[model samples]
Target chain A: MEKGKIIELYRKMLEIRLFEEKVFELYGQNIVPGTIHLYIGEEAIAAGVCSNLRKDDYIVSTHRGHGHCIAKGARLDMTMAEILGKKTGYCRGKGGSMHIADFSVGMLGATAVVGAGIPIATGAGLSIKLRGTDQVVACFFGDGAANQGTFHEGINLAAVWKLPVVFICENNLYAMGTCQSQVMLIKDIAERATAYGIPGVSVNGNDAIAVYETAEKAIKHARHGNGPSLIECKTYRHKGHSRFDPATYRPKEEVEEWLKKDPIQNLKRQLLEKGYLLNAGMAQIEREVNDIIEKAAQFAIDSPYPPPEEALENVYA
Target chain B: MSMHNGDGKMRVITYRDAIREALLEEMKRDNTVFLLGEDIGRCWEGAFKVTKGLAEEFGDERVRDTPISESAIIGTAVGAAITGMKPIAEIMFGDLTTLAMDQIANQAAKIHYMFGAQAKVPLVIRTPFGGGVNIAAHHSQSLEAWFMHIPGLLVAVPSTAYDAKGLLKTAIQGSNPIIFCEHKLLYPTEGPVPEEDYTIPLGIADIKNEGEDLTIVATMFMVHKALNAARMLKKEGLGIEVVDPRTLVPLDKKTIIDSVKKTGRLVIAAEDCKTAGVTAEIAAMVAEEAIDYLDAPIRRVAEPDTPIPFSPPLEKYVIPDERRIIKTIREII
Candidate 1:
């Protein structure tokens, strides 16, 4: 990739990492309400896949969806406001972290129900096909969702119909606390795509360039009306399933090993080696990201809560 | 497409055909409208033949046959609806809706509100719910009350061909998720339907029969049972009013309450189980709103808390009938 494009991807990854860190800080201060599933380590997959999509293309996200929304161009202040349960936030504070969405950029809302958004993303692709539009939908789910009946049903329908949908599975190796080996006998989640007669590939999710290149090919295949494909990005979460539970289930060595290969750090090291970014450029980007996160947190704290009567509104239409 | 007779005459058709006509007219009127379900295409033409000949008319693209995944069927419809396509999905039987409850209740019913009015789900779920058929527990059920309890869903229960065609057309035109419930027994039953296109609003109630001595609030197949009981009561110098609240969620509370006030008596008849059922909701509404107008305590006619048995006699015993309506009415009067 060119220097400018690589820097763009690096900046996006940084935004997600810094934004989530700020969310963790706010949570510690008891300002961000409700539970949160931080996307701290798996930033490459969202940044990589969403970088290739247009503003008109649709994406259905999961519980850990803040990274996806940010990559899809959601404003950091609104996302922070939503997490803080403010009236000015996306969804008017009705939807907190788990349900945040910005339809203006085709972020088709995040569903907390495991694997439920799979078929909905397929439906969005079906709508695109029926309308004779070239738009595509990126369906994001976890390795655990691959076991859900919706995974089978949703992918089968999209495959049979040749709908423009790319199923991206972020295999963090563990669903909450149970490891992947305990649930499935298979090694790679992407291999399950053969059952639906679609191409499937597994790539290093910690490497931004690898994920972006793989997603580019899969998205092209979908845009050309060939069919849907599954791209399994092998990665891990940096925190527990939610903020409350401690992830002691993971081995100390395993956590330490994965933390060294963190997506943002990996991308930064690659950028420096390829002469895409200088030391001063890297420092400049980090300072800019930190400034943005601080402002978003302040805006969220300063925003007002929605009036009690506003709850009764928007129930219909 | 010209089912209308230009000459002044009432065009009659079966309840199943009325629903089919509504779908056909709406699909033709709006290119965005389409249909999808298990075995609803050309080969099967729907399990109840409600979509007979539609696949041939609209082609496989518009009238699509889907896999036996109920969740995908409704979930995809929700996706399509939010994306500007009006998809009418069929779940074959209402009992099977439990498999897709998350999509229906959590996703479709809550999306627009949860998303801060960013989108509207103009989707319709058409299914048959009743106990007249000997399909047993897995197939026979009256689950309209379940959808009624959902905040964002509009539950439409059409007892006759007129209401079926009219309410279904309205459901197609409106921008909301609707659970259109058709009764199994009423499918083949014939009734007078107008040739011209018409639509009945979702919240309106229709008085099938007017009387003065007592009022009977009924829905779906129970409306017919209540009317039959009303006729029997009329022969014995008693007058009974039969009111069918066609749509349950936006219930015609005003009409029902006014009927109760005029007759000074109320009896709610529904095919669902007696506890926490449609009858209970209406009975409670009347009790809260028109208690002072009642000359006697309210009575309820509903199925007992048991699944519909396969045996013919047992099935007949479990389903509410005209005899049960009459007994309940007599008690209230």
Candidate 2:
């Protein structure tokens, strides 16, 4: 990666980490309504995969989708406004955090249902292939979604047709507290890809550069019509599943061990060591990102709720 | 290509031909419109011959065929619709809708609302309903009431050739998920349909025969039966109004209620089983809203709450026929 590009990636990872932290804080204070699935430690997976994508290349995200939306170039104000249920949000306050979408930037809406977007992304890939466009779709899912019928059916169909899709599984080791070992006998989620006759790659999701490189190769293969690829990003979440969880199901030692490999810290260290970012530059970037986030929060706060009559406006068309 | 007249007017055509014409005209007009179902294009000509020559004209890609997997068929259509493809998936039989209820109810029906109206699932599920053809219980069930209960879906059941063409055109152009129910018995039945492109809006009910004594609201095959019953009632100087609620979900309750207010009585004739069916819901709505104008209790003429029997006589006994509808209307009046 270029020196400037490395710094930009680090800045994005930091922005996501801080944005999520702020959201967590606000959520605790009852400012953000409804439950939130935070994308704290999984920031590198989104940053790495989305770095190689263009504005027209599509991505379908999961419930933990703030990082994907930010990384894919959705405006911070729109995302925050959506989460806050403001009319200025990307979906005009109709979709909450789990359903935020900016199709103009190729973020084709995040889904609250696990594995439901897999077939949708594959269908988008099918449309691209049939139209003879080189556009590719990146479908994101959790470790738990791998067990869904949609995962098997969607991946198998995409593989058979050689549709332009990258199935990225962020195997965070827990499906809302159940560990992978307790759920499945297999150690690697990537091993399931072979059943669908697709190439699967496992990577250290904390390493943004490594994730980006792997995504680049998979995206290139997909765009070339070589077929879909399965990428399992081995990562961890810093927070519990939702607002209510105490995370008692997880061991303290494992949590501390994973915390040591935080993607934001790793990226910042790499950038600083490579002479891409100085302390002053990093501080300035933080100030700028913080200002943007503050403005977003204010925008969300100032926006009005949807009118009572507007509830039935978009039910049909 | 040529126009012919019978009885010194335009010639009549079957409801099946009207549907085929609608598909052809819509495909020619919009490039996004496509067809998919089991034997829709090639082998058996759509099981009811509704898509007989479409594959030859539009090619297999546009008029595609699929394996007999109702779930996958509906699932794929839902996926395609969300990704900017307007697909019309045929369920082969209305009873098969049970196999794909998850995709229909949980996914397609809720995609727009769940996604906060950011996405539109502009797909139509076309299937033949009702038990008059004696195709047995599985093939002959009426499931429109099932789909009508869903909030985000539009249910259309056309009884005439004109409606078969116009309502389908409306369904294809509309941005909502539509359940277009066609009665198997009406496919060969003939009527006059306009040659021009047209659409019947989703929530409007059509009054077939206007009268002042009792209002009859029916759907699919029952509309024809109700009309026949109206003719029989007219011989005895009984004035019976027949209203066809083309779309069930966004039901034209105003039309039915207004007619009931004028007539002071109501009889909902449906081919589906009576218990908790679409007729029961409409009866309850009318009783709630138009109670002041009612002189008699709202009567529902429908099949018994049981699977359609394979025997012809038993099937006739179960499904509401014109004699039963006429008797019910007379009793209500």
Q: What clash pairs does model 1 have?
A: none
Fnat values, candidates in order: 0.75, 0.31
- For all the predictions, what are the DockQ values? 0.85, 0.37
The CAPRI class of candidate 2 is: acceptable
| Candidate number with greatest TM-score | 1
What is the clash count of model 1?
0
Report the poorest 10 consecutive residues by lDDT, candidate 2 chain A. A308-317
Please provide, for model 1 over B1-333, each residue's C-alpha lDDT reduced to its tens digit, 9 standing for 90 to 100.
Answer: 122335545688999999999999999999999999999999999999999999999999999999999999999999899898999999999999999999999999999999888899999999999988798999998999999899999999999998999899999999889999999899998998888777788898988999999999999999998999999999998999999999997999999999998999999999999999999999899999989999999999999999889999999999989988888777767
Best by lDDT: 1
lDDT of 1 by residue, A29-72 (tens): 99888899999999999999999999999999999999999999
Report how far off residue A28 is in candidate 1 (Å).
0.7
Task: Give the interface RMSD of candidate 1.
Answer: 0.6
- On residues B234-310, what C-alpha lDDT tens digit does candidate 2 reach at each position? 99998999988878878889999999999999999888988889899899999888899899999999888999999
